[model samples]
Target: MIFVPLPYVVALLLAILLIQMVRRSDGNKPNLFFAALIAVYALQSLVIGTRWGYDIVALLPVQAILAAIIPALAWLSFEGLRDGRSPRNRPLLLLHALPALMILAFVAFWPMPISLALIVIFLGYGSALTWLAWLGPNALGSSRLDGVGNAYRALQITAFAILGSGFIDVIISLDFAETGGTHSGGIVAIGNVLALLILGTSATVAGTSQPASEDDGSGNEIPSPVPSAEDARIAASLDELMQTRSLHRDVDLNLNRLARKMGLSTRQVSGAVNRVKAMSVSQYVNDFRVKEACRLLANTDDPITRIIFDAGF
Candidate 1:
């Protein structure tokens, strides 16, 4: 009788998810990053299963490096969703990679601190993601309005999963200290599988909500100007455009596309909507969609499903 390890089963599931993501990818950076993150999780699961189940002593460094990469990739994938672009600048990219590089350094010359470093990396990135999610769906200004809610929820789940991974590490560390690693195997087997599954699934959902764009080059960090006459004019122009052109009917519409139609940067459009409407761009557009759906439901005999599609929901 062959006893199959749980992580191997998890790796198989993650591989399926990775393949699905790759097949569905539209060459968008966020999608690709998400796919890579899933791939890494699959590989890490396989490595963990082998190392623990089969006692493969040679895979320790490989597992450490891969573990380090997961949190960084998760951060980059979600950050891209928020910024509407991957980190293209060399400096920014390097800064994001610093934590993983440090882990690699520890793995190479100083293995004692490897576990501590990983715990720190996971907890730090998890906290960062939590903060991003706490800012609300508006923070993901690049996601399609119709899907922003799901993306926000996915971000929240991923944040919690990452934080859970950190806590798992703490538990394993405590177990090793108190019991001489007696319970580490059981903990890793169950804890890691659950964490990877949650992280991978949530990331896949978030990727589907990402807009297909290389870069809008809009800096979201800049302070939004107070609602002024200029903002009112921009909001009026946007409203006129949406009403006249029925841009809300486009199911794929996103902030970048709306801004392009208005001949303004995404920041300008989002800021104007935020200031004048006192709502995120997504909520503002979704309001239009809801109204259209309601009108159709009241006046037409179309199926609810058809009306939903027509409303771009």
Candidate 2:
């Protein structure tokens, strides 16, 4: 009988996900980063299966480097959704790659502390991602409002998966220390495969929150100017515009398009809505949509399905 390892199965699933993402991509940076992350996870799973199942000792370093990369990519993919800033504008993005580069350096000369470094990297990124998610859907200012909640939940799941992987590493290390590496194979086979699968799936789900635009100039570093009288004015203008033009009825209405229509930056519009309405931009627009839907349902004899579509739901 031929035997197939669990990681190989995971690798195959992730590969399919990567292909799907690539095919569906709208040339968005978040989508591209998500595809790259899935591809990396698939590659890592393949390397793990080969090394553990086939006893391919030569692949150990490759596995280590890839493991280091997974968390970094996950972080970048989600971070890109929070604001539509491109990679070039975010200089700190290069810092995220340091962990993987360190792993590579360790692979070359000093391999002893590689496991410890990986644990730190995983836990650190996991915590950061968890915090980002904890900030709620509003934190992903650039994300499409319709899918922001799902993206936030996906971030939480991915964070937990990354943290779980770190804990699994701890368990495997303890197993090796206590049992002379006897049960490490089974633990790695099961624990890693599960973690990577969850991570990949959650990441794909998070990627669903596409940004409104790639270059809306919403830099994460710059603080949104404090709410002022101008914010109230902008909010009032936006309200008038939405009522007059029924912009909320457009199913594709997003921060970028709305801001462009108003002749303002996304930050200006989002900040105005957030300040004046005490809600996210999506919530504010969605309130108008909900109200319109209610009015239509009460007055018009339109079919419920048609009402939903007409209300931009």
Candidate 3:
């Protein structure tokens, strides 16, 4: 309410924090996701701006708009596909349209009290969340999102938390209603704080927080490695190598040379391979080399040493 700019203050802080997060991220995907979050703030401003000295009644339509946007933002932030494309054939951009649709729904059902409108508002929001889980990245294979150690699990849990919150809110509202809005009086306030806390925590874990982790700018946090010209050449070479009768045959193949070819630092390449495949680069390479050797041995290879060398040992 304008009388007590708490909502505006909270929303403004979160909006700023999220924008900073986007700026700190080295990846475009995370940046895009956080941009959606910024839009949420813009939305809040749009609704509340009209009420300078008025009560929260002026903010109801704003909340109505937010109902759909909240869920949509959650989906975009956490559940984008492996390539960052939405699972929806149209790229799931449809999720962003939800806020408008919801606002329209409110107008179509106008003259309803803010309370009743909120009911339908939450209903649409909840449905969007469920749909995201059903058809978005949540339904995709877990292996992709859950990479290694607790990384994938962390992501999955956050995704679940977003969807779960909607249900929890429903139960809270029911209880609040049973006891007359008293219980829900400060509910929105509490929810706002908690939401930012959760998002901030996730941003920290996801490497979007600043002042940087390890607190060092000199080089504790490595730069993002992309496919340079040389790296692309190496990738292409590796692809061709994989097509051969023997590629993984080199059990002791030097990683330095591979990293050199790929235009990646040894640490960067190692981390990427390990995180993506859940195995050390050496072990992965060695295992593949052994498999190739075995295949040649069982099939029709001229000699074991030849097969070993051919396999990239």
C-alpha local distance difference test of each model: 0.79, 0.79, 0.50
Instruction: Candidate 2: give its CA RMSD in angstroms.
Output: 6.8
Superposed on all Cα atoms, the candidates' RMSDs to the truth, in angstroms, are 6.5, 6.8, 14.4
Model 2 regions lying over 4 Å from their true place:
26-30, 200-237, 244-283, 287-313
Error of 2 at 192 (Å): 2.8
Report the Cα lDDT for candidate 1: 0.79
Ordered by TM-score, highest first, the candidates read 1, 2, 3
Model 2 earns a TM-score of 0.75
Q: What is the lDDT of candidate 3?
A: 0.50
Clashing pairs in 2: none
Give the per-residue lDDT digits (tens) of candidate 1, residues 1-313. Answer: 8978889888888888777667765564336677788889889989999999998879989988898888888887778776576556434777877877888888888899988888999999999999988776657767777676667778888889889999999999899889998999999988977876686667576556443222111213224457989899999999999999988888878877888788887767877887887766776777888899999999999999999989987
Q: Please write out the lDDT profile of model 3 over residues 1-313, one tens digit for every residue.
A: 2255455665676677677766755454453554675567546544543343244565555555665566566555545532334445445477567555756675668634434444554455546555544442213222121122122333544555455556546655676579855555356556555555665565455552222222112222332345456544544555455456243543324445455555666555545543444444444455576677788889974697788677665
Q: How well is each residue in 1-313 modelled by candidate 2, as lDDT tens digits?
A: 9989889888888888777667665564336677788889889888888898998989989999999998998888889876667888898989988999999999999998998898899999989988987765556656666666566677778889888888888887788779977898899888876776676667566565544331122212223446799999999999999999998888756676778788997777877876667666776778888899999999999999999989987
Q: TM-score for each prediction? A: 0.76, 0.75, 0.50
Give the Cα error of residue 255 in candidate 2, in Å. Answer: 5.5
Off by over 4 Å in 1: 26-30, 200-235, 244-246, 249-251, 256-313
